[model samples]
Target: MDFFTAQDNARRKTGRLVVLLVLAVLALIVVTTLAIAVAFYLMGDQSTAQADLSAQGMLSALSIELVFGVAIGVLAVVVLGGLFKRSQLGRGGRAVAEALGGREINLNTRDADERRILNVVEEMAIASGTPVPSVYVLEEESINAFAAGYQTNDAVIGITRGTIRNLNRDELQGVVAHEFSHILHGDMRLNMRLISILHGILIIGFLGGMLLRSMRFRRVGGGGKRDNSGAIILALGAALMVIGYAGTFFGNLIKSAVSRQREYLADASAVQFTRNPEGIGNALVKIGSHTLGSHLQATQAAEFSHLFFGQGVRQGFSQIMATHPPVKERIKRVMPDWDGRFEATWPKQPDETDAPDSLDSDERSAAGHRFGSGAEPGTQAAVLTAASAQTAIGSMGQPDQRHLAQARATLGALPEQIRTAAHEPYAARALMHALLLSEDKATRKHQLEVLQQAAQPDVYQALMDYGPDVLKLDVALRLPLIELALPALRSLSMPQAQHFRICMERLIEADGQVSLFEWTLYQLLLNNLSEQGSGPSSLKLNDLQRECQMLLTVLAAAGQDDPDEISAALNAAESELPFSLTAIEDISDMRALSLAVERLRRLKPLHKPALLLAMARCIEHSGRILPAEAELFRAMSDILDCPMPPLLSEEA
Candidate 1:
């Protein structure tokens, strides 16, 4: 399935989860109400209780109002608990990672293992055409990893130390690819929702335990009405404890039901991504053979179990509550010809220092190479032939081996010094400022002065040092450089990041107007730095005709210089839509386009495919996808949450 279909499926799964939660809560209410009725009946006078039991049914002691009250109370606890946990996770994947005691790895780490994993993650990010996510390393010895976020922009990749230590490059790459599938398929958002909803369900048990503990501190020795009240309190606490623990059992059952099939899909996607099933298959075999297996030692393991690449926690009910498929079965699905034995051990793998910088021989010989061997950075171009445009759309969220090779090539093309600068927090800030500097001498001088005065002294100096190299970077590499710098930029302190944004604004305005590149840089930068609010995504194209026109007008104006060509492109794109579009002459005011694109970002999942196709149609109208046009197109796709891999030139 493509990105849209996968997202739609995730939405449908969420609906199923809600239905299950309702059923679970309803069951809780019936049990709790019945328990309360029995407690009250038993607490009544001995003669009266006997008479009532004889005269009416067990439930007769409970009024309809009492049952309704119990249902409302249980529902309130569950819903409120879920909402509370959701709010607590407002920072998205980072919060989840931190909650599990995973430490964020510095992008500039010199540790060989850290660097290797970072390189793998960077390649995957570029291959999949998503921003480089912050990577966190758990202290656990278990071989497992996970991707978590409400959406792509704020997503984080986390793996245990054992994962990096045990798996070789290909195996690690396969594991990372599986996690990326979660990010691309919209599973992270669903996973977050599940975490929140399940927390609510488990709240009853937490409250019950707390009540039981509170009773331990209370004195209940007086033999009068007070003694009877103590008995009732103790009974209530015990009953709640039973009901609460039952909720835990049902919650895991819900998790297992929702997570199992997705693991199979992710495993298959991993194979499709690398075209090397043995990579992931071996990783799983290694996990099965290892004594620790994939079981996490973290206290929060069970709570976030479903988010794991493998089962992160020991299952209480085995397969019935297992969040992932059995390892041997998963291996068989990925490698149908597998030799079934969980290999006790494999030959010692190469150390990180001796690892190859590229994919294995077979993977490197993919049929359709994305770039020409002789083509240099900045000059290498990708064509968007009619066939290629459709291919690019289909490739969204489904990056292949060719795309991985292209990502490696792009990373290799960057100058060593520039790459280093991009990965350092202070230098990254300097590099971004340098990229914003104008070509015009006077404008550049003014921008430098603005930075010298407003930027941190060290950052200003770093800018001066890297300025020439940044100015000399390849046009195609410029965006990739920005992608590389994001993890470092995200490392900035809030106040420093705010200052960086202010300085960047001054530099962009120093040129008197926002150029297309400047707008792209600003939008892409800010979008990654900030959090986007989640919405229903129910809006259709018909709901925002004006906004759609504005977006197409901006894109047409950016890609075409001639008025006739602009008009033609707009009309072509509009043909794919239900309505006509008119070009805005003064497309200089990018804020209008930004607003329009923001509204379009909420386009329903299935509805997005057509809108994106319309966009591709407009950009490819000139019969060639220029580097700048390609950059703008990718930016638009990124904003819309439809990651478009780097366009491959037909000439290549």
Candidate 2:
């Protein structure tokens, strides 16, 4: 899928949803005003035995001012309810998961099933070049999963217990891939908005129920007058309840319209990502065969029904209000020639003996073969031809099987200890610290001294313990390793995350000068630790000419050491742009480069592909993507919200 196009489409859908909500609110206001006016007329006119409850009579009974007052009150309640829910979800995916009683799965989990699912998620994240999202497991028995976030930076994957126990690895990968599509397509933000806005509409119903319940405890013992007052209260409460439920019915229709098609797209995306139709196709079949059939047992399941891989809640009175298409139909789309049967059982799984954490010698040998063991890591030429560069750029936000295989091999290539460390919060921080340790003896010692002073005693000890293995890591694997540690690093307390960031900055500066790799690592780590918000992609390439120049200047400098060669790279990059460019005299001014990137990130969606092409041209000027250059390029692309797959040699 074209990631930017999908994002723009999702934005348009959000606009349409807002319009529908306004219409729903207007309908509610009119209905509520009429309900109140009828009640008032009957109570005030003692001759109510013959009172007209028709629209004309009600309109006459209620003054324009009274109607306006009721409309304002209804509008206020809906808006406030929505705002309150939105504010509650401001923490993003984590809050939603917690509300569903989802426990954040420990990355270092020893349970085989948990470990298996985590592996799939990590591989997908690495393949797509996004940071590993925090995974949460719900206690539910239904076969359901969901991806949630305002943006990829804060994204999370949630799975029901039945999902892990029921599906095998490929099926699980397919399900995970489907959720990743949601994340890449900018659907999560839209889903979150849907939840909050729908909550507002549903709150009117809740208020009506509350009003009805309160009447039971109300004292109505002052005689006939009290009896009339009670009757009016009863009438108003009943009317509000009916109106509230009517609003709910309309809200479901709105959600169904907005969500159903996205579900189909996600299913197709899963197939495209894995290149194995049976993976997701069979998964749908399994959901169909199962008794629960992807139905969630959580009380709030209906609230988030639209976010699930399958319909998470019971169907509405009409199929028109179902958030996902029927299971058999979904299966047919994935597996066209099917006989329409869902097997309740699959082949039994082999008992696990070796821990996934362990890699035997043969496995290591195979991984080394895939990545080239003898050659230096980042020195491999990436994007050997123009077509290859374009292919890589086009693959952003949609990684295929080859990338998945490469991610698996990359994980296998790492030392077992480092992989283990990458999963633990404290060890992950240490690994990041060790990644910054300099190669030179004096510089390395100074970096250690900086960490020793600023970091916790335990974190410092872990770094010292594994510093050697980390330093010996292949250059290409370094960034991926950092990506693996991200989820763990994210688990760090706010104070700890702050301290970690400060320590990293101190370490990078400890060497007195920042290498290209160091700059890239610092930027990548810091960016992942914070939340990223996307803006309107209204600015064209020309609008941010200076920012574009600064960005290309830094990238060109990183790729080519010679001043003349840097200019050559810039010239090559300029050929791809609408305007000429100039290289900055102070290429080492990392601060300026950072600012330029922050600005460049705001380029219009369609304009980004061209800028990315220009970046590829600039780096390709050296005729090869050096390890440092590749790191910097990927880091910059990630900050731009474009996920660049891992760069590798042509032969690989």
Candidate 3:
């Protein structure tokens, strides 16, 4: 699916999920109320059968207070359970990895398997114009991997040991691409919501299980207390057990309906991304033959089964509630000519010699031109050159084979020191410092002083040393350079990361006036490298007028030279939005602009494209975008997880 269609589907699915959740909650209330009334009926029975109360009267005897209490209690439990789970996951995708015993891989990792995955992840991130995501390795010897998080910046990739040891490089790339599909298509957000809701439903089962255990071995003392109270407790406990499992049943049903089809779509998207059906197709064939296949043994396997590359657990209930489509079905979709023979065995060790053929020289050179690498030396990419053209989606979340080739060349073009620095935490922090350093000699000296005071002495020295090289990097490479530094930034201890953020803030605002370039760099660091990784907020921002007006004002002011041009650009952008912007103004104050971006950040995916269009229009107000404007607009889009391809003249 295209960008808008994919976003539309996500929105519609959310509505469908809400409707389904409401139905599930109503089902719980009805079942719970009946169970309670049955307990009361059994308690009353033998002697006063029809003498006092009818059956309707018995259900009617279910008091209004008790009914309301049951309804409210169940609803509160579900809501609270969902909120608690969401909160726990809010710690970021790292929590998802930790939940299943996945260990974070270091950026400077020497281990071949670890290095390979990190490289693949980095290439994909750069190709898609996203921040490089952190990678984690699960110790289990199962051929499965998953991408998790609320959005792009905080996203993490998790894979099993078997996946590393068994799959060749091309197969691994296919698997990674599939996971990336989930991230780009807005699937992760939906998955997080599903996880929270299902976890909430699971609370009922857990509570019932605890009650059943609590009743074990209690003394059978007094006849009255044991007979009367024990009977009621027994009935209540049994009823809860039944209700809990029922909730689980519906929850899984919802997960199945929501999750199964997405797997197929991801598979197709992976092939589209890499332009090699065999890459992904062969991986699935191997999964079919491997002993572990994709089944994970983690206790929480069932919890995140939907997130995996394949079925992470054995199917039950006629495969009706399976989180992924069958392996055979998936492979056939990618390879229509397959004769259904699974690969008998996979290599025990990953082999570099057998990697899938990458781009040929012609393909590489062509990609270099499209990606700005093959252009004249020092000429930056026009990734967001036209404010208007860059704003409209080209392959917004979809990067084709050329992007893959470009990513490979891009990684290869990095200087040795920068590449090496990107692999270590302290050195990586130094690189970040250097990227934010001022070009003005006086300002640069002051920034260096702030870094020495706030960061480690060694890092401060390294930052100063890399100053020349960092300054020489082309504008187009800056985003990808910072993207490479992400995993290293993540490797720092929590305290260290916090200190880095403090150091960066001090360095950027130290001059008292934040330059547009400095602000963009600051936004990137703040959003991605913070102690709390960037995640979707719980707030819902639907009033697009106020938000778009504010955001467009900042964008308009940043990109346009003339006041009239700024107004015209803002008007053009808002015209595309689902809202009106009647009072567009030239907002030059950086603080006000930053606040506007922060406010607009919480908008759902459907509204963001409009804001993006407005920003592009504003930036192109001069009829053509300059390199500086292009980079700043790209940073704005990056913050919103809106990936913009390199802006070619023809794209306009």
Candidate 4:
């Protein structure tokens, strides 16, 4: 789905959610009212005494009870809403991906399978005009894949080892396209919201379970209460808990209904995207016939069933509250002639004794060959032709197989070196340096050498020309380059990776300020890298400190005229740095850097250049420029490349 459709769907879901919430509130109000009436009716003697009491006293007593009941009911709703908001379903989905020990595979890696997966995802992203999501591989034998994230920017796609081993390129593409459909249509967010809301509705039931266990323990210890009032209270709590659980049950039913429909949509979208129903249909058939059959044995599988390419969790409750459509029914939709029985004649496991000789040999040999090479020339040509053919055959306006093939070819053409370098820490740094250098032949040559040495020739050239190309063309080309390059960069070592990130920050602050596009790109790069590095070590802020120091220097230079202003700017900028600056040495005096720059901008806007120059000086204080630090300087120079500075005379 496109942005508008996704937005409309979200608005519609929000409206429906609001209506449901309102109904829940009304239901709570009605239930509370009835309970209060019942309570008053049970107080027969007290009611009579109250009637006989002074009018004011009776009024006060009734008022207090009514207030308490209303307050409790209102509080319940508020608490439930808050619970919904804080529900970790989305986070849980991410956690599952992380627990699977999935890492960002380098598209340029020597591993052909990993490269193929990367290529397909990138192709799809480019074709769809969306940012390529980070891809991870789970080590499990289950033939399962899931898409998870609260937003497109945060989304991740994970596939299992079984899937990698079992499915061919075409089949894998179909599975990936299916997950991308979910991301595109905003289904992941809705699913997360549903998890949260349902959690809220069932909070009381969880509490009830705890309470019952505690009561059981008390009884065993001979300390359990047996008074009539206590029994009544327990019974009341149990009843409310049951009722609350019913709410959860119904909520899940609703989620199931919604999810099932989306599954159909995704299946349709996948077929459309690849323009090959057989590819996806065959994948489904394989899942049914395979030993794993799409079932994930992971304890946390149920939480992510809705996000999976197929059902990952099996339970009696799942049938009633399943977030996926039945596999048979889905298969039937794609292949009407498909019987309910598993296709026993389908290809067997790779090493199975009974496996067909033709199938086993073909697969084994194909797996051994490099991606795009093993295929017959005619087949490749046909795929390329089909991929280029843009027939809108699916409900979601899927492109023809030719278009998909073309996409695949485009991805195949990306240089392996650049792809490898993208994951290196130095790639982004190198790209940043190249992008900021003066257009002089010597500088350009130096930049090229740096990029070549950094091992990203394709990307280096691309970065060098990106700005000019962007200026000449429109913003459309930018997404393709970024999408193509990002996954490769994700494969970098942590410290090396951090260097690129630091480079990005400096690039953003190159001119002593950031443009909207620059800021957006910076945030996007950060988020993309962050997802790849989900571990504690990956989350370390060491490189971020270095970047802040570089930024402070830029700010200091820009605000150098007035000592007080520079000092203040240094201090503020230091604090405003993206990571912890206090812990870093020599940055204690940089805290007011941002404030000083702001004050300077307010007092003397045109002096921005001077302030920026001062900041650069601060960054260069160590005398000889480190390669990484030099990149920062290059970035600043590039941002000021316009209007062309003249060569200075030696005498002057």
| Best of the candidates, TM-score | 2
lDDT of 3 by residue, 399-471 (tens): 8776676577666666668887887888888888888877789988888777777788888878877778878
Per-prediction TM-score = 0.93, 0.95, 0.86, 0.59
lDDT of 2 by residue, 1-652 (tens): 6877887788788899999999999888888888887778767765553566566765667788878998899889888999999889887899899888899999888877788889899989998888899999997767899998887778899998888877878899899999999988878889999999998888988988999999987765445643677777788898988888888888898988898999889889889889998999888988888877898888888889899999998895789889999999998998898899876753223353224534578878888766556665344323444444566678887778878877888888887889999999889989998988887898898888888888999999999899988887777788899899999998988889888889888998887888767877887877777865646656788988888888888888776578899999999999889999988777687887778777777776778888998999888876666666666677789988788877645754
How many clashing residue pairs appear in each of the predictions shown?
Answer: 2, 0, 1, 45
Off by over 4 Å in 4: 1-3, 21-93, 99-116, 220-237, 315-320, 344-402, 432-438, 442-479, 487-502, 505-652
Query: lDDT score, residue 63, model 4?
Result: 53
In angstroms, the error of model 1 at 207 is: 1.3
Q: Tell how far residue 581 is off in model 4, in angstroms.
A: 46
The TM-score of predicted model 2 comes to 0.95
Error of 1 at 168 (Å): 0.5
Cα RMSD for predicted model 1? 3.3
If the candidates were sorted by their lDDT against the true structure, best first, what order would they fall in? 1, 2, 3, 4
What TM-score would you give candidate 4 relative to the actual structure? 0.59
For residues 209-313, write the lDDT of model 4, one tens digit per residue.
Answer: 666555553333243433234343454455555555655555556567568888898898888878888778888888887876888877656545666888887
Q: What is the lDDT of residue 409 in candidate 4?
A: 40
Model 1, range 334-408, lDDT digits (tens) per residue?
Answer: 988988887564323335343534444444433213333235434543555655566778888888887787788
